[model samples]
Target: MMNNYNKEEIEKLRDLIKDIDTAMLTTSTPEGLLSRPMMTQEVEFDGDLWFFTMKDTDKYREILHDSEVNVSYAGKSYVSVSGKVEIVEDMDKKREYWNKAYEKMLDTSYDDPNLVLLKVNVRSAEYWETGSMTKNAVNLFKKMTGSDEKDPSDMNKTIKF
Candidate 1:
């Protein structure tokens, strides 16, 4: 079951993932699940995530075959976002998200016809934030005393919008 997320909850989710740079993008392929590391675009999290990709790549083709995808991030917190993807070719949007570093990395100008954007319209997300050391120690003590069965470190929530 998914819970309807409020603005505060959405903001919390965004704050949790803001610092995490890369996300593992998982897609369905003929061989099975294929996961690739994609640099997360710095954008406001309003239920959509964007990444730069080439239209001719296998990842793009796989997304076309199966639009459902998962993007995962790990750090002090772990987040799993599942969504439907669409290939965007709008030049204005490209200019908005493009950066000088990308030019050096891709060896192509923003105007390159092959350059495309992957827009992931997030459906739902699950996040887990590990507790601090002190909290974990307290939870461990509680467990040892048989006072708590759940660990404080196991902080997780699922939200749908």
Candidate 2:
């Protein structure tokens, strides 16, 4: 299925999620479902989600066992993407997205010591956004006076995974 997000709403979601920086990465665990906050370098709405993680970590194992996962980011706007995860070892892709800070934090090069990439093919996603305070107040005022207002995110565009 596709997400029924409109162009304007899509732009709003992109703007919101891009700056959120951190996303809660979720996976199924025997104990139940597990989630961890991960830093996002870039999140493009081009049908796939890309992230980096240590290849030797527990999340990697869980993903291998079951690829179903969700990533969420929220700031002024909120977004949640659900799909399947794949461990990618593409050297070129890694090199393209690599950063010095990542190596500094992980204590190893991007290509070194069991580093792996998590790429998700988004099957579905949801987004919510709030308009400017001025706009919000006007809408509220109108509603209080018995007027209908257009929602900020009801664009009618399908969200591309």
Candidate 3:
């Protein structure tokens, strides 16, 4: 399916997730779905998320078998992004995202042949945020009074990119 993203929606998404540093990246595997915590790249979001991984990892193999994946983030709000994974081997692009943290964690430089970048082209996202206590209480009062009004939780939204 083609992603139809608007600037406002994209910016909203970026705003929600910009402060979060880590996300659980779920990839389809032959056995089942596998999820692992991955450090999210700090670059400004533009419908894509990037991660650094070695070529020989299980996630890499899983991505090769099935590109479909889900990435989830949690903080003040919860966000789940569904997308396709693209394994990038471009040296320049790799260098652009490379940092000291990666060098320390992976014990490898950006020039390492085994290092690869996984680019997730986000297709859609669903986010849930807890509303203010006042709003929640108002929704509760409405429900108790038999008012057919939407609950505060109903504010949770799903946006298709």
Candidate 4:
């Protein structure tokens, strides 16, 4: 069973990543880890991240073989989330996240049987914001001085769900 997430942390994480539209999804493979760029579903995140994929794709097979995954996003900030994925075939959910862009990119409609949703139950996330140079320099100076105190504007943080 999934543990309850802190609402504040969930909201903070959602705000940080909502603007990032694409993510690199990494899945475990027998050989090693495989990663591919996937379009993130434009829905409010509440400890779960969603992506669309084809049933026959390598990612789908990979998820089946090993559910553990990592999703990384880059923008003004960089975020990496660790999670486990579950294949979802709910048509309502597919339609809810579907859009013309997906149709054009996938060359299929939401009703396509091959199209499915990968619901990633996020376990934890680490993020780093690209702060102003002054803040970064100060942080670097603090690190160099071996200061254990964290600045309120510290660029990096980890959130656990």
Candidate 5:
């Protein structure tokens, strides 16, 4: 799938998610679907998403059971990414995305053996973005005024990665 992506489309998808600070990572459990907030790695969106996790965590176990997952982000725009995930243990890769805050959040250093990375190899993504603040404000006004017309400034796209 990665081989089929054109440079422009990848950049467009990257632009949509670039400023998102957190993503809701969802995995399937025996009971149902479970979602947890995950800190978004401050790196370029390169057809994959990276996350930090502990080896003993529920998400880790769930991923082992079913590698399929969903990750969603809401900022000025909203993005939902469906992908397959696997546990990654390479220390160098972990260090590349590491930050001091993670130490405080997980109560462990990056060097801890319990530390692991969730590598989400994106399959497909859908995003909805409201073009600009002014346009969004106008849309809001129209909605409040009981206008039934759809806003032209609203944008939506689906990308197969």
Candidate 6:
């Protein structure tokens, strides 16, 4: 169940992440697991993933009950990251995902009483990247030619993201 990926493939996965702006975060609660989609603008990935949320939200409470969580981001390409979610209440971090636009949208400062930042220390992730129609066609062509070459469409890379 392990296909070792190279540094180039690692970067490709990260690049796919750079394009998407939202993720559906699934959290485990005492009741059960629930999923909620949230804008990923506040997500700060420095090898260790970070995201902002409300302290009073159910997602936050669920994390408290069980740190185990799954965060998925996808579009043309897809990424599913499995890791532990921790609450980061640092003042400086509050100011990082904070912005004037965010204030306008949420009608509150980043330091608002309800605000919270969930840092996901991504340990490992799996991806299924079927790039585009052209890429798919190229993959088929490779198969037909018995090239056994990698086509961008059949990308399967796993990494810490």
Model 5's C-alpha root-mean-square deviation from the true structure amounts to 2.4
Model 1 lDDT on a 0 to 1 scale? 0.87
Q: TM-score for all predictions?
A: 0.87, 0.75, 0.86, 0.87, 0.86, 0.75
Q: Model 1 off-target regions past 4 Å?
A: 1-5, 133-148, 151-153
Q: Which stretches of candidate 6 lie over 4 Å from their true place?
A: 1-10, 42-44, 134-155
Candidate 4 colliding pairs: none
Q: Give the count of colliding residue pairs in each prediction.
A: 0, 2, 1, 0, 0, 0
What's the lDDT for all of these models? Answer: 0.87, 0.76, 0.90, 0.91, 0.88, 0.74
**What's the residue-level lDDT of 39 in candidate 5?**
95
Tens digits of lDDT, candidate 3, 61-105? 999999999999998788999999999999999999999999999
For candidate 6, what's the RMSD? 5.5
RMSD per prediction, one decimal?
Answer: 3.5, 4.7, 3.2, 2.6, 2.4, 5.5
Models ranked on lDDT: 4, 3, 5, 1, 2, 6
The lDDT, on a scale of 0 to 1, for candidate 2 is 0.76
- Most accurate candidate by TM-score: 4
What is candidate 2's lDDT per residue for 18-112, written digit by digit as tens? 77778999999889999998877664655566888897889999999999999887777668878898788988888887899888877888777
Off by over 4 Å in 2: 1-13, 132-160
Model 5: lowest-lDDT 10 consecutive positions: 148-157
Runs with alpha carbons beyond 4 Å of true place in candidate 3: 1-4, 132-149, 152-154
Clashing pairs in 3: 4-161
Best by lDDT: 4
lDDT of 6 by residue, 78-98 (tens): 888888877888888889777
